[model samples]
Target: MEHTILSLINQTNRNIFLTGKAGTGKTTLLRKIIDTTYKNTVVAAPTGIAALNAGGVTLHSLFQLPFASFLPTYGSVPLANELQRIENRTSLQKHFQMHKNKIQLIRNMELLIIDEVSMLRADMLDAIDFCLQQIRRNRLPFGGVQVLFIGDLLQLPPVVKQQEWEVLQQYYEGMFFFQSKVVKEHPLLYIELEKIYRQTDPVFIALLNHLRENKLTEKDMAELQRYVKPHLGTKTDDNYITLTTHNAKADAINARQMEALKTPVYRYEAKIVSDFPEYMYPIDKVIELKKGARVMFIKNDPTGNRRFFNGKMGTVQSLNDERIAVLLDDADVIEVDRYQWKNVRYRLNETTKEIEEEVLGSFIQYPLRLAWAITIHKSQGLTFEKAALDIQSVFASGQAYVAFSRLRSIDGLRLLSAVPQNGIESNEEVLQYAANKATEGQVQQEWEQGRLEFLQEMAMRTFDWVTLETAWLQHSSSYSGEIGNKNVYKNWAQQQYAKVKELVATAAKFSKQLDGYFRQGASVEYVCERVEKSVEYFIPLLSQVWYQVMYVLEKVYYQKKVKEFVGELEELSNNMGEVVKKLFRLQQLMALAATGKDFSKETVSTERFEALFMQIVTNVNKQMKQEQLFTKDKEEETPKKLNTYEKTLLLWNEGKSIAQIAEERNITESTINKHLIKLIEEGSIVADLDKLFSKKEIEELSPLIDALEEDSLKTVVEQTQGRYSWDKLNLFRKVYLGKE
Candidate 1:
């Protein structure tokens, strides 16, 4: 069946869908095709964590859907400006033009393979198909693209039931009919690969197969005894042990596994419903000292008590003490203590900081390694290397069968518990409904008809080119010697062999059928044409042109408004420039004197500088108050409350640009410039005036600037004394003369 499916895939002109029971190797085959044939393939899963597990991007991220939101933002997608930002490389540009430009930048691509197809909603698939069609400008679905959908039918269905699933069901029903017919008519090379490698015991395999067939045998009960028996001897490395739910089996099994290696386990418990205590020290302090540390935590507490009791499981995070962290399969970080650290268990190296940064700052302390765990749901799709399954728990219809058959090789399995046949219920109503919907027969007919048509077309297209090539190879003297003869023989052999095999296979498979089975009127070209047309018909329906047009119109309108607004803002700012200059000058001088720079023998003291600046600020407030520029209540307020202008003045003194101070304080820098303009109006502070400073003033100002830059008052004082004459300075003379 695998080879026939591969042949069909090689010939199919449009998209293909593959579906089967769970654990059917659909994903495995899809990956094989991608690795061997498709080079430029992008694989995506529906959910983020699932994508991570599959080593692919999520469908939501690929579609650029907003996380945690229902209403999708559409219309003019913005192009990330590479010249404007460094991180824009991965950023998806919003506009269609930009998206096209980015697509054009890609060098080579052949296919897009989507896995977990059963979980995909029809609308989401349609959306993806739409985007591809528009970008490629081809009259085919996904722009004449080839897609392979791989998934199992029995696993969890799409989450959105009403819209997507219903649409998908209808579409899949049509495809399923086509697939089933192809399998029946053709020599479909289906490979079941029933060898359960994970569960090696023959008895266990028989038990599992029986259970899968809905027939539990007595041998299954006997096989489970090995796990249940009490041990009388020292534990052998290969000995199997069973832990019960009441016995706290999961944790005990984990502990025993670790103890076999002579390693200690670090245990921590947390109330899942409440916050972890603040004083509980972090895990890093304990695990750093030891290697191969086994850690277990309570996953669920059924009692609902405040404290943890039973129902804990052993889940180990391999710790890399060199990196000071433990690595979880989900790529979560846990800083571990020294004593409980496990070095041998983890793969350690210098972390890939670049890859970490690419993932939008998810802090992964250590790189990932393959993990082993029993997630009942996820285990459905996998065939393990070895398996130890316990099916003593209640089986809900198909659950037991699905769990048992997960083992591929008979010898690779160990059935830890017996299946209870009495547990199986024959729900006749449910069975009847399923039987009615089994449309598998109809699907098979359509698929066979499609395959026959495709094969007939290929056979008709075969020319005598191979015969001509073989003749040429034989006659050409340039290919003389043993190598030439060998090459000629190889060409002739391959051509003759292929021709004979195709004729014999076709005759053996189809000759037995009656005249009506051939469907003589139905041509392969017609089938191909029908498939092509079906794709083209959906192209226009999926195009998002209206959304794009609306986005473009909105963008143009906003650009015009922004241009006008910016112009008015610029003009207002220019008018306030002079005021800003004057205020800055006064603030700078006062700031300089207040820093204790000795200007002269009678230079202003630091106290006097501060007092004078405050007085000046007070006077400005009073002036503004007199003009009633300030809105006031009838009650009197303090001078501090009245001094609104001082906030702007202080901002200037702190070396803030006039524009910045205005924005922060929510006032116009122009208004601030107006106050400075007033200072110029009164000739209190000069505009663009570089006054010739006395040596005393320079000495004082330099030290203050140095102090501010260095953030040290003591250093400023030392630099001041070294540079200036203390004997002649007024403030210095006062101290030296012993005057109060």
Candidate 2:
């Protein structure tokens, strides 16, 4: 069970299906992935409530897919008229053409995480697949992107219209997305969490397991009926939440309960400061609350102080035009503050391997919801300490199971009507699948082994970096150390490794956490997050710090290369952003140590040499602090320091490769592509490009390359498919594309 969950922590980018019975921490696992992994992940759910619960967007809202019952059933790109019709129907044409950025976001996506997977139908999933392929211009499944599916099919089955089902049946075996043609062809690896975390009573747990496995018997039904009675008692503070089959029925209970309070009702209209005000409506545009009304916090506290949390229920003690007070179930009364919900777009910083959010707009309001009585349909991702059920009102399959499972224990449940012995139903296909998965304990073991292998590989790579750092410090320099001290460079190297050693040790902590996670999924992803922070974010920047030293040393031996490097710095500084001030200062040091300067003896009066050297060191040190390179909770606290294209190219000119530049800059290649496009348009590197390729070659390649909008080597390789080598493509982009 631990491996089934922990295994994804280290696994390379791949599609995975995380499924289990109610309250198995599926949503918890998704949050962990969002907190740890470096991939550009976008999350979506089939329903708005599910999307908010998942802290993501709705599938339709994110993709702008049509609301039609069936998706287009075809393998090829639609003709012009067909596309036009789709555009007119869904308004996707303007979005696709007007939003170049939206296209880039989709094209560069590494992971698309869908929560509450059971509610997404086969046609809808195929439709998403088609949209991705069309936007990315790739024919591969999901446009060659990795997707994560999270939810249990046994709880909620997809809604299939008769027409959609008829169209889907030709391509899918069933209505579930797993039965879709693309999924059938490229099946995602399954990981079912076996541990039950929501319910504590073993006997009650056994009944839930039987429900999931389709093994419910008359005896189990009799056990369930013990709590079911003809008349439910009057509402009390401890009464379980009523579950109904219909929204209207649930609304009736809520209205009646609120009216029963006989307290003054305050109606507050939400203030939306965003473009999509209608979409921002979670429960409604106007929220009605009364004193003594049972209400739940719809969002976590902004600072995450835990004074309030999503799904935490309480009673409204008082309210006015300027204030609101809530008494939590724990009897602690606190003034409630308004929180802002932003509609954010994320950009992956390839250099940092961190997701950066751009706040497009926001909805500012107190996140409180009426909680006296909620429908079983609306109660789906929530957990309750106490609950009541009206199983007699259940109209669809799995509704009863959902209603009963919200309670923490059987003792908390009070059912208001007799339930049929065979009233509850689960998807038989899912039950059979879970049954089969139950026997494959080997898969879980394999997951553990794979984790060990990834950790070992990381350890080995860390060792290689240490070796590279040490050799560069010791052997690469043909000259002596800082003036008046032959060991000045060696001392600098020592200082560098001391930091490296510290970071490596910081990274090693994950090994212990992996051990802990192998036994219990630790609530805090301490190791996964710290390792990601240490290696991906900090170490790369640290490595670039060493590369700076190399750049200075290289200037003495490779004068021409050093000249090219300085030119890049000067040109980049000349462009729109701030100058790489430290590197700009380093250029002066290189000027003093030009072509044949001997450093075997003290050549400088301490004042000049020490002053300049100290300045360089101080500048580098200051940048590290600004970036918060050593902070443990930087991901949560610090704002990102983006590496401008000029600085990225300066590192490039220092002989660092694109991958190294990405590490040094802390951003991704797609993001890097955006920077380079701006650089080309700015004419900052026109002279450099002229030297790399002839004008004729540049002209010939520029138009041919224009056919492909992106400057990535992969795009060139993919479009030309070996007609040109990577070197040629790289040189062409560097020399030709941004002609001045």
Find the candidate with the highest TM-score and give its number: 2
Writing each residue's lDDT as its tens digit, candidate 2 over 1-740 gives 54344345334334678787788888777887776554467888997667756777778866777665443443433333322222221433334452545665676576788999989887678778877877877788898677889998877788865644554455567778787767878777787776788887999888877766657888887887888754754374763567777888778878888888888888877677755446546666678888888888777777767787666778899998768899988888979887776665555442222245666666777788788777887787777767778777665567778887877788877778876666566677776555545334656655546544444343333323333334434432423433432233455545554655565465456445545553564422343444444334543444445445533343333344344334432222121011122222222322323332321113212233234444555666675565565565767587666557768667656766556767777877555555555665676544365544457756667777778656466866766667665655765665555432
Query: TM-score per candidate, in order?
Result: 0.36, 0.58
Ten consecutive residues with minimal summed lDDT in candidate 2? Answer: 573-582
Reference-based TM-score, model 1: 0.36
What is the alpha-carbon lDDT for the whole of candidate 1? 0.39
Kindly report which residue stretches of model 1 are placed more than 4 angstroms away from their true locations once superposed. 1-4, 19-28, 38-40, 65-98, 101-110, 121-144, 155-373, 378-418, 422-740
How many clashing pairs per prediction, in order? 56, 11
Candidate 2 Cα lDDT to native: 0.62
- lDDT of residue 347 for candidate 1: 13
Task: Report, for every candidate in turn, its global Cα lDDT versus the true structure.
Answer: 0.39, 0.62
